[model samples]
Target: MVTSIILINAERTKINEVAEKLQEIAGISEVYSVSGKYDLVAIIRVKTNDDLADLVTNKMLAIDGIAKTETMLAFQAYSRHDLEAMFAVGM
Candidate 1:
């Protein structure tokens, strides 16, 4: 799976509406309301890079209240639980 983190700048008054609409899009796994330079963050999961591109460019960007977005493609993923499990098996 390919995962991407998308930082979204949305119309302040329409954040909830934007988030709701985003949730309806395919390949979008999660949406979060956050404070900072961006208004919302979205997690996108897809089968291939082409699908990711289509989701962000064709679908996400076309949403009504999205003002701007910064998309970061994930290179690797690590978690505390995964690390602990690996060490436990060795011991």
Candidate 2:
């Protein structure tokens, strides 16, 4: 699986709408409304890099309220809960 984090800057008045739209997208697993440099954070999970590119460029960027975005690719996942669920204890 390919995991990516997209930091989005949406029109100040449309943060909620933008987040809602992002959450509805197929490849985007989660959307968070956060405070700081960026207004919303979107978590994307896809099968390949090409799928990610298509999702970001073709789908995500086409949203009306989205002004700008910065996408980050993740090399590895490090979650104790997830690892345990996948591999079981002492495996």
Candidate 3:
């Protein structure tokens, strides 16, 4: 599985609408309206890299009111429980 977090800069006054539209797109798992350099953040999960590319290029970029996007690809993840387990193993 491939995961991407897309930070979206939307047109003024269009954050909510843009976020709502993004939720309907395939591969988009979550969307949030945020206060920062970007207006919205979307979490996308796909089966392959090609699907991720298609989602960002065809679906997300095609949405109206979206000005720009920064995509971050996740490499590894460690939860609190995982960290505790790792530390305990060496004890």
Best by lDDT: 2
Question: lDDT values of the candidates?
Answer: 0.92, 0.92, 0.89
Show how many residue pairs clash in every candidate, following the order shown. 0, 0, 0
TM-score of 1: 0.84
lDDT, residue 11, model 3? 90
Q: Which stretches of candidate 3 lie over 4 Å from their true place?
A: 80-91
Backbone clash pairs for candidate 3 read: none
Per-residue lDDT of model 1, residues 1-91, tens digit only:
8989999999989999999999999899899999989999999989999999999889987889999999999888796854897799995
The CA root-mean-square deviation of candidate 3, after full C-alpha superposition on the true structure, stands at 5.2
Poorest stretch of ten by lDDT in candidate 3: 76-85
lDDT assessment of candidate 2? 0.92
List runs of model 2 lying over 4 Å from the truth: 84-91
lDDT of 3 by residue, 1-91 (tens): 8988999999998878899999999899889888879899998889999999999989987889999999999887556854896889995
Q: How close is candidate 2 to the true structure, as a TM-score?
A: 0.90
- TM-scores for all candidates: the values are 0.84, 0.90, 0.83
